[model samples]
Target: MQDEDFLRRPAAPQPYSLTPAILYLSSDAVHATHKLLQRAGRNESCVFWYGERHGDNASVHSIRAPVQRSRRGNYHVEPESMSEMVRDLRAAWRPLAQIHSHPGVEVEHSRYDDAMVSSRRILSIVFPYYGRPIANWPSDIGVHEWQLNYWHMLSSADAMARVRLREFADVEVRDFR
Candidate 1:
């Protein structure tokens, strides 16, 4: 499927929004993410950094946590591993977001996700797997951000507008792989 196909997919009944506004990702990062999620099968999880946050825009850099086996529909990051990743990334770049895949499910934040969000300002992305081929991975990418004591799910258009409200209307998704 094409990139536009992702937007055309039906929206889930959850809130999603890009907290700061804009988000950027490298083609390499996107490709690797697809591969990682595919290898993870359904319900498995992987974690990554949204790179450095610059004002209302951020870039997705690399995978901090590789795909790991877990129970159906659940994946947990070890506390120690998470702390180490945060420490290492914070030395140079802050952890801006975390991306995970929902195998055979729509992209939405589960209660588990909300509970795990902690108090940090981070963008949580859910990629729809739905048992589709890897080429069709991320068929629908859900973007969510915690704000006003809730996780708001923003449509693609809304996300773009939010990111562009204060800056230029033209938002670019550059691949610096």
Candidate 2:
């Protein structure tokens, strides 16, 4: 029920690194996506820490903008926003990996979603929230299970960084964990 619980829970420890300025997701990282989705609805952005090596230093990456409520009744990150995101990532010299929500259901990429994801030379993270209660959750920590799925891209180290810079403009870094 709290972020502390997540921190203390016995789950696979995904390797990560935190900068005084940003958090990083190392390769082999995994965690719950459900909580993230819920937070996104509140217009809060989240990032992932990815490292190239299995348990090496990871970087914090965030998602910008809101997930559009689709006309077909699904949530989606708008293409225009995605384009801007890619541009921003290129500017930052990071790869594209977006964190989005699935409120209370299974989060999986649709065919359309895949098509969009495939167009980029980055990673895609589909976080699905299963409607767990976190009212008593800590502001700094959270826990959930994330299934591993990815697209292969030749990189210097088999990893990429997807950062959400918009968060820095709105909230303090402490609010992100």
Candidate 3:
């Protein structure tokens, strides 16, 4: 929705603005993420996006696959593993989103997913079919953000706008699995 429309709403204005947050990702980063997740086969997998955020826009330059336990249904990343994954990363790079894979088409957040996410401030994206390409990346995929008391899943259109995929070089992928 436009800024004017958002302001015209009847309810009390939210503490946060409705201005959409944009995540800039390169095609290389997207491919690396899929490869990392697809390695888990029928199990769930996760890769964290770390990058530079300026205002409401961020550019994902690194994809880290932390050492985590994975199963057919879920995955878990330990605190120590997370610490190790980013030990050498630059201080300025921030966690942009947590991307994971689901075995099936269902990409909604489970209760476990809600609790396991490293940060509510970042986006939680779930890729379907064990990270295989599913009806174009980021569209059918689950892209949720923390809103109010829950993780609100954005619509396909919103998801596409929120994550802009571009052709670029120099997307680094770190696999600590």
Per-residue lDDT tens digits of candidate 2, residues 1-177? 121111222323443332222234422222233344454453323343222222332244333333343321244455565454344332333433444433333334444344444334344544434223433212212222122333322121222222222221211111222
Candidate 3 ranges with C-alpha deviation above 4 Å: 1-18
Descending-lDDT candidate ranking: 3, 1, 2
Total residue pair clashes for candidate 3 = 0
Q: In model 3, how large is the Cα lDDT of residue 162?
A: 86
- Across 1-177, the per-residue lDDT of candidate 1 in tens digits comes to 112223332334555433436766655565556665555555556566546677777666545553244444666666665665555444446666676676654676766666655344777777776323344323356667776667766676765544221222222222111
What does the lDDT read for residue 166 in candidate 1?
A: 25
- Name every residue pair that clashes in candidate 1: 15-152, 15-153, 16-152, 16-153, 16-154, 17-154, 104-130
Number of the predicted model whose TM-score against the real structure is largest? 3
Inter-residue clash pairs, candidate 3: none
How do the predictions measure up, each by TM-score?
0.68, 0.37, 0.87
| Model 3, C-alpha of 167: deviation from truth (Å) | 2.4
Off by over 4 Å in 2: 1-23, 26-36, 39-58, 70-73, 83-90, 103-105, 118-120, 130-177
**Two-way TM-score contest, 1 vs 2, winner:** 1
Clash totals for all candidate models: 7, 24, 0
Off by over 4 Å in 1: 1-20, 66-69, 130-139, 160-177
